[model samples]
Target: MNRPADKPLYAVQDIPGKGKGLVATAKIIKGTRILSEQAAIALPFGLPDKERRKIISQQLKTLNNDARNAFLSLQNRFPTKSQYVGIFNTNSLCIKTSTDEGSFVDQAAIFLIASLINHNCENNAQQSWNNNTRRHNIHALRDIQEGEEITLSYVFSLLDRAGRQALLKKSFNFTCSCRLCSLPIRESQRRDGNVQRVAALDEVAKHQRSTAPLQSLQCYHCVLAYHLSKYGREDCEYAQAHGDVATLLVMYGDLARGRYFAQKAASVFRTLLGSDSNEAAEFAAMARDPSRHPQYGFSMKWKTSVDEIPYGLGSADLENWRWERLIPEGIAPFADIPSKEHFVKGGTSKKRHWCFMGEIVKTKLLHPVQLEVKDSGDKKLALHFYSSNTSDTGNSLRPGQYQKGYTVVILDALQYRFEFGCGINQEDLRMMKIFPLRLAKILALNKEVREFSIRHDDGKRKCHGCGAKAAVASMKRCSLCLSFWYCSKECQTAAWTTKAHKTDCKSLRDPDLRGLFFYNWDEAQDSISFPLQVADDSC
Candidate 1:
């Protein structure tokens, strides 16, 4: 086989521990189109072995002498009765085409040079079918040095190291020795965990059509973070994740951020799949006017014009504004409480302080202690306590504490899917607390915290007592809740007595309640305790 006159970037060569592979002959810049070639043979997909072999033989007769030689030279690890069929199976790449009935059909085609590229879990190049040109195009995902092997990932999705090894060995009859597969066990496991979490978040995004806009946007942000942390900017999944987030933001009427993310997604797609790809063209247009999208305006909760984006922000502030990730000042970092509806089984654990605040309607101690309770949302759910000692279930509370109107707080609670109903399973003694206040009073206090107590770095901090912005550290925080700031002791006392803080201060004094504000909820790097100072400097 001979290389075409225009194809001078790479050449076919014998690779170590592998058969014939493509090796770069000259430096290839990122986003460069390295190879574009028509298939030497094509056959219908899903055909029986006998029928496919007959078709392959017929196509083989029509190939020119050079093309026929190249097809015959391709690798065939699984040899069978029909040599032509085995060669086709080993070298053919699946391509989408239309059938005579005007419906889509997947067809397998053998490309002489494209098939010669080897497999790598962390591939430096990507391949796609260019339907407009009726050929396969390979683009450099990153700059490829001369003498380096041209590679692409054979698997559709990334998997753990062990899973990748098993899948490659079973399907391709070879083990992958890529960069990711050769990492230390601990580092490899961390990367695998990130990928798995992102995959879970992807499933959540798919089912979030009926979910609230803010909640869906949160899920998409979490997915994007996982992808960037694991695969960095070069991975194709990173771009796709941004696209998912952009779509959700646009749907919820966040036009400024939506267009920003859409443009980022379009840039990456242009690099990986070429500017002519449908994904690149579609996202490029969406970035120009996000409101034009079909799914745009599902909710107007975050409505903003495309030109309303902030300017002149520092790099860190720019990212915070772009993602809406600015931690509200004064409101405890991990303690931005979430509802039970946000939970998903086998999904990523909650990284912020969330409690199931419910009134105990009834109680039973049969085998495992159970309580029938109604949450802040007025939805009833069961709370099951599964401690080794039954005494630990109530946390030393008297029978009077289990009254129908008494509020029970379970910290960092998750949604437990039970045969009877979906509820919460209280496991840790320290994670649960009982408050004398009713559920309504507690929620009202929480609303106050969200509005007046939370701080923002826009050079403003509203005094909880006087409702005035203080300069720097001139204000003092209420020592109990550490929630509200005051300009003076007199103001604090007047507000505490007159502003309903008198009722909320006692409930906030509980160690568990204070811990919720201080604890690091994103991920546990180390054990934590009460009177939580910023251990990770995350705040």
Candidate 2:
């Protein structure tokens, strides 16, 4: 019956549509702990309804006259007031079930402060049942302006506007007009579809089992996308979603991505829920080393030691690192190569792979300055061209006549700090192509090549020289290129001597050229220009 001595923010007056609610007296920043109190009365679970009623009635009688009268004055939604149990049932929150030990079979606490909080479709506060504390607590998820009613959601899962309205009307005895409740039907449906798809995708990921390390990266991507989208940020769902992603990543061996996700989740939780809360502490531990978790290295595909986190990632890059995927139109050239330092050195060749892609916005043939202009599919790429035709008079292309929207591949690229015409391919014309589309679409084709066409392992290879299926280990590699391996020395000799491997070998040996076969270019980061650089032997 006792209210916190701190003056009530709002007078305990009847809230017209809603039973009785508390309005904020001043703006409350997120993560502010509003109130914490011990329960005045506790009852256990599952006695007969009649017996439970008798117990609550007897307990009420023990309170002082003023406290008893104040307790009885609380609002009731149920139509009938004759039953003492009905009034308690209408106002009391379910604190703990009977399984946990308490005085009564089922324990319910009457929280004077918590019960005053209102419900809203677009709530800025999140309420949690903290079993550790044995009390319900509410934390602000966003800034709550003075005089605004502080509301929390009643439903366990996020409900769409219509679904929320239906549930609220039935259980809470009020219609909600919060921002979510007022969204346009079409926009509302679109956002709802995203939410539903995210849930469905989680189930799909769970149902499909995998034994490899990092095997769940594909599934985690679905949840990651949903949390990053605009709608997910509006609610506390983003933090919870990131926490789920971090947990799954850590279960595998991807401490790099897992730690990044956990840090992100922890940040959000620190904002929506107090930093000292259990959820925040859990994520903080995960952010240190995802692999240190109990489930670390459970799968082999994504295995990484605690020390394997990458170094060069910036703040923005850390975010992209968590997801580690490219948007459909992002410009990324090094998408296919293995990121681990040991793999490139141990597996096959010292050379690392990469490809350059550019959209030909203009073309003009003016001999030595045969200008075939291009774009990096992004404005940030700084689309300027410097000619290295190397002759007084070489063939120039006609403006807008030759392939306009095309990508040109530069082989064995080196950084030329001299000018914009940096990746000077000695044999530029031979490998470059005008694909009649955007650079993004051209990269999509390369993605298909990596996913559907190329074989990754040297142990299992399909020869590009003769189209023969052979184990890479036994095969004799071309002396000049080392890119094409043959079944026998005879096959190798034949490839170089009889087939056109002599020409192909030279092209394949070029590190930039070899990269076209290895990287997962479908996942892009920032804008990539024509002619990607091949990493040095050490990378």
Candidate 3:
């Protein structure tokens, strides 16, 4: 093997349960290169077992005595007549190399010393193929004390404890006793839950390219959160999550946060892969100029300049701005609204609960009642009622209540393509609700909820009556709307009589209106039922 000129940081030693393993001989700091060596023996892929065995034997015969002795000393988990093939199978690292045709091909190579590094679910080191040097490189993922065994994970990240144990036993012929695997049952299960969420978020991110910009951003935010919480900022997956979130943000026209996340991704990539790596270079370019991204300006829904990022905020406030997290302060219980155009048919599983809000523009009673509606974005769509029983449809709304300007909210709304055009088909009466307010007024109220309801660190609420900000826990909320806070009955009376709360209170008191905001729109694991409760306990 072509070893680097520098003295090695680790040495091969006998591990207690594991046969031979690599252990640090000196303290190794995080990001330090532990080893760099050329392969001792390399074999091409896709060849038949017989032919491959013959090739490996011939190659073994050609090696010098020292090299041959080292290769023979490697582990052979699978004993077979072809000893050379057995040694190679037990200790080969997959590397990419150029073939005779000048195209890249995957080759398995045996590294004499590096192969001795054992597996750990919570490894302290990472092994990567450095294509520029044409050598296998191992780096410390965290500080390693002298005499500590340097380890790497053989399986993918975020696997649960049971999954990790099963795969290690089935493939490696060993059971892992890593720190993560040795945790108590309750903590192990909690970690498993987090890992499962990370995996689900990853699955969602894979399809973000085809999803609507807003939906893609939402998925990326969730993915980033899980990665950061489980893996920390230094983990490769956490850096990758930042990069993905940056891309989606730029696609949706949020250049400020996009640039911020891109810079973070670049910094992490530089630390993990060295400053000269292609990944670091690419992200550095993105951080410098996010608008140059191919997806820039696709949707200007959240347009912002690169320098528009906010300053002087606490960590929580900063995170809230970065993720566009919805605060529940003034929000009606189940009032989260999602655009109809973003809903996919069967492909859109419940990532989170969402409702569609639109105003009735026209109504037709065909085989099933059809209502023409206009969304908050001024886009026109149709909602068709398919209930056979009038009690479930017409009886739910008084004759004049279905007239123009009335707002309708449907939970778990989905897009359906019909002969006429694409729209929503309503089948459950419990999922549908109508309010006397206009679509604009309802949206305005939602905006107010977004603004005043969120509690600040100072424990203050923005008074709906006078626009004053103060600690208002002792204050009374408008009893009718349950949508605003007031310091006293006088303020409440004034807000009711003078601030147009009279009309707002009447609209808000409609059980359907209150239900629209009270439903748990963030719970995505199951379908919501009617007679919507104040909170989703499942979440």
lDDT of 3: 0.71
Which run of 10 residues does model 1 get worst, by summed lDDT?
326-335
TM-scores for every predicted model: 0.65, 0.61, 0.60
lDDT string for model 2 (249-323, tens) is 767666776787788888877766566566778889888867667876666445556566667756554444444
Candidate 3, clashing residue pairs?
329-453, 330-453, 332-517, 333-517, 333-518, 333-519, 334-517, 334-518, 334-519
**In each prediction, how many residue pairs overlap at the backbone (N, C-alpha, C within less than 3 A)?**
3, 29, 9
Q: Model 1, range 45-146, lDDT digits (tens) per residue?
A: 678889988888888899889988988888887675478877787777777766677676778888988988888887889887766667787888899999
lDDT of each: 0.71, 0.55, 0.71
Global fold similarity of model 3 (TM-score): 0.60
Give the range where candidate 3 is weakest over 10 consecutive residues by summed lDDT: 327-336
lDDT leaderboard ranking? 3, 1, 2
Q: Which candidate is the best by TM-score?
A: 1
**lDDT of candidate 3 at residue 465, scale 0 to 100:** 75
